[model samples]
Target: MSKSEYNTEDFVLDPEFRKWVLTNDPEAKRYWEEFLSTNKSKIQEVEKARKILIHLSQERFALPDSEIDLQWNMINDKIDHMEGLKRQTKVVSLDSWSAIQHHKEQSRQKRKRNFIRTAVFAFSALGCFIFAVWFQSQKFDDTQEVELSYETMEVPAGVKSNYLLPDGTEVTLNSQSKITFEKNFSGDIREIELVGEGFFDVAEDSLRPFIVKTQQVSTQALGTAFNIKAYPEEPISVSLIRGSVLVTNSEVSDFKEKLVPGEEMFATLDNSTWIKGQFDLKQALAWMNKTLIFDKTPFITTVHSLEKWFGVTFTFENDIPKNLFVTGEFKDESLKNILDGMSYSSRFSYTIDGKKVNLKFKP
Candidate 1:
């Protein structure tokens, strides 16, 4: 292993560092960059926090209430005090476990006493547990539901998956993208979130339109076929094939536009800028054809896509050069081969491990 495996302990016990990571504030970016260059002391803590941050940063697509409930139950079981103890033992100090256990004991005794007044007290406690579970199940049923959905889907490179939505929309997801949506998919407006890229053949539902929400803007359609390429690191773009669509950023009232077939819209997380232009649907949605496209994309931008699309990581010895850009494409390219092709142009240099591909200034 490399000498600098990145100690996790320093990030854990160091309040100055922990506070920097706990929030989504962009103000913390500088600190995170600095920490990356610093010593790696707290291995477990940093790893744990890193994972939590990854998960939280990830997009959550809409799931049916039933599916969501099932997922919540599984998560709830693991997140209750018991699972917390296990995670703390592995990632942080867990002396608080005793306090938790003590409280649990007290609660148990109180519940035990309360049951005594009733005949068949053991049966009463069992009934209460069952009732509590059923009530929770029913409680979720009362929640709202939407219609059509668009979600950012993520898959590792060399793998492909297909998704069928409630509205009869079919999405064939590519590696490392995600889709998020509301359950009913109908409301004051229809909405779905997307990251990476996906080929969407949306089913028509006139009552509630279909919408795709990306880091930058939203795409609304009645029943259309289109593809969206929206990476937070890069501006969002949409290419429609079959039907017309509207792209708008109600989030930034100033930014709004309508799109028709063969047209595309581009926007970003920065400054709510929105742009519209024509697109070659064939070239734009090529990922549906097992192809990866790049056009004057930045070195880091490509790296970020690879990480998500292929589940890889890239480190750098020094800061990436400013204003660097890459123009190329990959079709089922191996990680090493793709990096080599980029470097062939004298633009970037890189090293590869199992999942990490480190790029550095060409020395």
Candidate 2:
């Protein structure tokens, strides 16, 4: 049949039409769009076929060929029986019997043609549905083979790493930090699980929200830049830079808060309470710029940061100093330099042993 004479069944069976429905090919899309604009009368059939294709794409199961054939046979038998009943119910009067018989024969032929057309259309639709099911089943099987495929990046103590995600999001991983995500990010959401600290400059995608999940909290953003610090023993904090984000306690689904630029959200792993306030951008992003800032940082906290930054282990010879606070800024400085600068004011002595550092009070 000519393209213009094609009906719903013909459209459904057309390979080109199916391609337009199932793929993102620009040429196919353009052709179909133009065709539909010009063939307004066939719009209904095109839409129906499109919907069937979409339904097939989302289906995860397929009917077996044997089952499909069985169903088709049952439907065909039922249609045949209905046609036979129409044939048996006919009665003709003796008066004008010839005329009546001719009329009845013509009517029967018309009905037969109509029935065949209807049956063909119905069968074609069923066949498309089955094809969709089988296609989805194969796709599901393919996905199952790669569902465990993931990419992981980790930065050891005393070092950092920078990476770009497939979606164009930039990430700066801090010392002893790790991020795990799907290899292809083939999902409705772009999600990454984080351990330790990382700064993310996410690409904007309204349809796919970027989520950073930590042990304590989860932060979600769309086209925003933010930093998350979630050390194993410390409180998790999210610092927003240029865009907005939503932070929520992982343990408490109802506990969610939105953060604006310059705002930081803090939540401890042990507690459900969340705190938010303005954060110092320079201090939060100091590591990314190779700068370390200690504004009255505690001795223990300082030790933790130093260990990660320098890839070393710290051993305390005596009890940790009480009420001790240190403040300093080192930009691209050596580990020894930072320690020497802090020891002068903290009155501590440290000896380095390969990757280990021992600290004690100087008499």
Candidate 3:
């Protein structure tokens, strides 16, 4: 039969359909998606078949093919034995058999009908037995403990990394950032633990919420783009680029705030108080696009930004200048150029040793 006419049984028994439901094959995914889109009327049947296939894939090892065949054979043997008894019951003495041959023939026909009915019942029983076994196997699987594994990705200082999650969410990790998540998110929720800084373009799935947890706060999104910066010993900042997200204290659930586009929420690690304010898109995403913008930033804060940007460490020999501010916009500029430009105004000298930089007050 053509695919358009295929019934639930046909789909369940199809090898290709089973493969698509069980494995990660791009072609199979496309084919099924397209098919379902065009044949919306068949969605119920398709879903039923898909669920059965997925269940079978999980419990396939519970019952071997050989064992299933042995059970069928045992059922059939019992049916055959009953049929033999029916045949023996139809026998009669020779004198009575001739005298009531017509009645005897009717009785024989009745016996045949009884045998057929018994065979059908036996087959139906067999089906019920198989279904029961599958149901019990599923129950056993549900109760069994599952050990979850995790995967981690880290971006060192002076570098950035981009990753695509299994659910098609896009993430860009900033310098000295790390994210850890389950290797296979086969659960109801999609969750990630993040440290440092990262930007996310989350895919929308109302059924499963995407969550990013930091040391101080947690950001939850349902199909939104946002940036989060939560470095140790610094205030946690969450910026929303598009869509909306809920920011909540990791320890205190009641301390929550909602963020909209072009808005930022900040929370300190020590205090759970949340502060929301307007944020500059250019300043927030400069690092992602390989640009640096220091808009009236303090001299010491600038030093920290440079270290993270260039993957270097900074040390001060003398106390940093009080009330010193620096402002600049650099697109793909070298660390030396940035420091040189800043020094022309800040009037401080700096020396570089491998990955370390030292600043001292000039006499």
Q: Assess every candidate by TM-score.
A: 0.52, 0.63, 0.68
Model 3 per-residue lDDT tens digits across residues 72-178: 67656776787678778865556865759957776986687567656865676666646754454345343455556778999999999999886678999999999
Worst 10 residues of 2 by lDDT: 139-148
Clash totals for all candidate models? 32, 5, 0
Deviation of model 1 at 24, angstroms: 41
lDDT of each: 0.63, 0.79, 0.80
Q: After superposing candidate 2 on the true structure, give the runs of residues whose Cα lies further than 4 Å from its correct spot.
A: 1-134, 137-146
Residue 158, model 2, lDDT: 79
The sequence of per-residue lDDT tens digits that candidate 2 reaches over residues 1-363 is: 766677655675678887765654557667876787777788766655554455444544456788768766776787778768977997655678778887898799768866775777578667766576445434543134333357999988878999988667899999999999975455557899999999999976544689999986789999999999998988889999988998877678678899999999988778755788999988999999999899899989988888888889999888876899989999999888998999999898999999999999876
- TM match of model 2 to true structure: 0.63
* TM-score between model 3 and native: 0.68
Question: Ten consecutive residues with minimal summed lDDT in candidate 3?
Answer: 133-142
Model 1: per-residue lDDT, tens digit, 257-338? 6777877776676855656788876568666776678888887777776776667777888887787888887887777787
Error of 2 at 164 (Å): 1.1
